[model samples]
Target: MRLITQSLLVLALGVGLARADGETAGEFDYYVLSLSWSPNWCIREGDARDADQCDARHDFGWILHGLWPQYDRGWPSFCPTRHRNPSRSDTRAMADIMGSSGLAWHQWQKHGRCSGLSSDAYFALSREAYATVTHPDAFRRLKQPIRLPASVVEEAFLAANPNLSAGQITITCKDGGIQEARICLTRSLEFRDCGADVQRDCNLNRATMDVIR
Candidate 1:
């Protein structure tokens, strides 16, 4: 699923045809690369897929969520044909960074398949998109819960990645805790402004970023 976008949960089931050739229904404007907070996901969905990542001893911060193709307002999904499944080695290589094998598979089936790239190429692009952003260290491993204005979190990220701006990212919060950081980028993998709908939902008031440990 392309989390933080219109097709957020479409990848949960990974519906569609799997074709040998890589063909998409259409092209997209840009991409929204989502980096979900591992600790937060473990806390909420520990019993779900990828329990190993939820272990208290694991020190994961923001793991690759999904690199979603996007339009200015909406996105395309369930395209005509799908790309083949990722190779065993590719899946293994991305497992640690992606959090789960199921996620990697589903992301390709649902979102990545529509990107007009082979499963291998689409995932490779996802990795590049993941590396395009520079996350703040404070959120990576907070020993204790920190309470700060959501703007501080956004500003921290902005400072870390000079190319990003206030409108280019969103600091998503759920149950009053920091959820994930959603960033907008061009098809060229360059930093860019997000559409209004993709902008951060952070508040000016104090918010909480619960430590992953």
Candidate 2:
């Protein structure tokens, strides 16, 4: 009886972990649109990997990282979905905004699957969400790298996009460089306040913002 009870307890724990790791598709409350600073990404990881995004030819600045479905609390990923996966061509078309077809495919498998939309629909919505916000031109016009507070990045975004508020967007830092700007939006693609879990703002006083390649 003791051994049987221990086995049941272990099974229950395993089930709990699975639930925490993933959730049902189309059940999220909102979306988080992440825009990555390409130069900073190259400086931190892409340069080492010789990623094509780091190449000077692309001249990418803020690129769409992913459009993630979010819950009010935590988040879901890798959720099982009935929709078909995107073909190579479908993902390749997103490369102009996403930086890479590989990243587009990965996003479809992870966050896109959880969106409850088909691959094409998910990509469309992601594009629409990205276009809804105006990227600050100042960042793109920078001739040299500068160190500035992460909040200033957020302020620039807010200034460029008056609809977005401080609570609706967050700036993140990685490896001491300005990383990504995440904005929360409703499922209908309207700006909305981010959930507490998604409001982690980087407090760096002088985070490096790399210039466009």
TM-score per candidate, in order? 0.81, 0.91
- Give me the overall lDDT of model 2: 0.95
Clashes of each: 1, 0
Which prediction has the highest lDDT against the true structure?
A: 2
Candidate 2 structure quality by residue, lDDT tens digits, 110-205: 999999999999999999999999999999999999999999999999999988899999999999989999999999999999999999999999
Q: Which ten residues in a row have the lowest lDDT in candidate 2?
A: 16-25
